[model samples]
Target: MSQDRDEASAGPQPAEPERGGGAATSSGPTDDDGALAPGAIPEDEVAPRSKSRWAFARELTVIVVIALVLSFLVKTFLAQPFFIPSASMESTLDIGDRIIVSKFTPQHSPLHRGDIVVFEDPKTWGSVPQHRSLLKRVVNDSLVFVGILPGGGDHVVKRIIGMPGDHVVCSLACSTKAGPLTVNGVPITEPYIDKGSVPSTTPFNITVPADKVWVMGDNRNDSADSRFHDGTSHGKLGSVPMSDITGQVVAIAWPISRIHAMKDYSNVFAKVPKP
Candidate 1:
């Protein structure tokens, strides 16, 4: 009876369920190390993680492209930056100063006397083009085109003193000690002229043609402006064509200590009748 009980107890033991079906039973899925197997890690999980990284990079690239496009548009139409290259504007705008110009004038806004403006060099204006190496020129042109750099040495800046059909005259005897400049036969006070400078030393009398404007610099004596080009071979080049005007200088943007809104001296020309 004792021997029979031992035999029954040791029988079979269910063969331990053949231990995971057999070594050749497809062995299940395994990790990189062939240790963990799948389920501890999902089959679809790693692919999504890789896709998420790719998605983030794509999104970032799209945002950057949009930002660049907006910047280009703003610079081309609304406003632009320009740097002062000479002392032509003196106290109002100095050499090396950077300024922001608004495109609204003569478009969305009316230009007025005493309004500072930037315009294309009217050829006879005697502006000297800056010389630079080919590589440097390319680099600068690119930056300016993208609105990342201020334009300089190519355009001119001055204040508008006469509009279409206004009779502008400066007497030959006019000196720093002499009193005023006449516009439309009315003597006008110019508070913006350089302290020791006169309205004009070289006299001129002309009716500004239609669609043209007479411009001058604040540093009158030092500036080769309308007065110098009044009767040049270029024929009435003194008066810049309205189309040549780029924009109205709205503010000084550089040299933090010099940052300020540009002032329009409307009251100075208020008493003068329109011509």
Candidate 2:
């Protein structure tokens, strides 16, 4: 009975766990507070992505601006699009034909007698009515300045017949005769003229003045060219100042069926000695 009482007093001793709970908790994912631990990221790895995007945008803007400037300069000083507004050029250049004119040609070389050229209309040529709205006008003028569109109003295209200081004469007889249209007493065969059209129905003889050129159209019968404007209000009707010449027609650029380079008329004037 004494031994039983002593064993009862030492009863209810603590027991050892079957699994290692402390080690399991220490090896788990989170800290003791149940919060996630943050990973270390290097300062170099967190680069400025927004800055890179902004830089790209700035570079694109610069490229677009440069492209626009280059286009404008080319149109203003090198070449431009010119639309044929009349049938004066006929088979060579019909109405609606878009041609490229090289402003550089007139600057580098003197205007030759057989070259086709575009020129600003003389004061006596009068003005065409403006049928466009303000918005349309602004848009068209802007596009034309950049060589994206053709010019409108007060511009004409013609072939040079007499250069500075050359004597030019015409006759209705030119349709049948080879020498009716003469420059400095030398005849020019114009095969480009519309068939059956006379060179000039109204005869006139004049010496082209210094710094001026006499011009005419290929479709002589239907054209109101230097011959038609003779003795007009400007007095210098048959001649346009070299300063008024814009550029030489180099090629037809639009309308897929009519795309071709401008004809070289060097052979046409080859026999004529320089004055």
Candidate 3:
């Protein structure tokens, strides 16, 4: 028993290469670490693996720092990415499309009609919990910090069809023509809309409240706007206060092939009737 015990206590026995010839003691750890005393690691096995790991860590830190700095600059003065989730702006923005919403203009002045802007989500949309989508949270939260979002994601992006105190109705009947969206009392022709979408499928007749504007998506058939939330006590669902309006979407900065300034609705607003 003593002799057997002595042999067992002799520490790890040398692992001889098996007849099959691969790494010996395949189930156990290999002596690749520098801590292996002297001959445990062969001359061929010696390399600057630790130094390589340290180099990798340093490079990764630099990349992260660059990303953070760019994010700050983007949130401060320039444009940033926003992922489109719904079909509200259908032809303009499809799901998975990344749009650039600027933070500079709205910070300086009131938004003009036809400007495509991102606002804080309305109360209903603003309260949806985080973790719903990491991309949404990142874009929404970034916009919030820059004052681009109304209240978190409560903001929305739409064409300003009616300005403060404008009595805007959806349709104006015509004998031989489809009625147009009227601001004040004149018909404004919007040629930007997708041909088949009927503007304001839901009826709306309202004097845009003081200090507020009426907004709607160009893709009128599939949007939830002031008309849909008009009577709900949830408040401010249908109309966004002028103060809640944020900077406009100036361009497309991603998917490189599609980059261009977001067309201003000025052409449409040009024909709107004054009160």
TM for every model, in the order presented, reads 0.79, 0.75, 0.65
Question: What lDDT score goes with residue 159 in model 3?
Answer: 69
Off by over 4 Å in 1: 1-28, 31-39, 42-60, 232-235
| Whole-model Cα lDDT of every candidate shown, in order | 0.82, 0.78, 0.66
lDDT of 2 by residue, 115-134 (tens): 99999887655545669899
The TM-score measured for candidate 3 stands at 0.65
Native RMSD of candidate 2 (Å): 9.9
lDDT digits (tens) for residues 1-275 of candidate 1: 99999998985766343455353443345546666432344444456777899999999999988876887787788998999999989889999999999988767888898899999888766666788999999999988887788987678999998988888877865644475778888888888888788888677777888898999998988997887777643227789988988899999999999999998799888877889
Question: Per lDDT, what order, best first?
Answer: 1, 2, 3
Model 3, 1-275: lDDT tens digits are: 99999998899878765564344324333556634332243545545799789999999999977877766677667765565667787677665556777777677766777777777666533345446588878887665565354332344667677777678776545212377767777777777665578767755677766666677787788877666666543224567776665567777655677777787668777766555
The predicted structure with the larger lDDT, 1 or 3, is 1
Q: Name the lDDT value of residue 134 in candidate 2.
A: 95
Per-candidate total of colliding backbone pairs:
0, 0, 11
Of the two candidates 2 and 3, the one with more favorable lDDT, higher being better, is 2
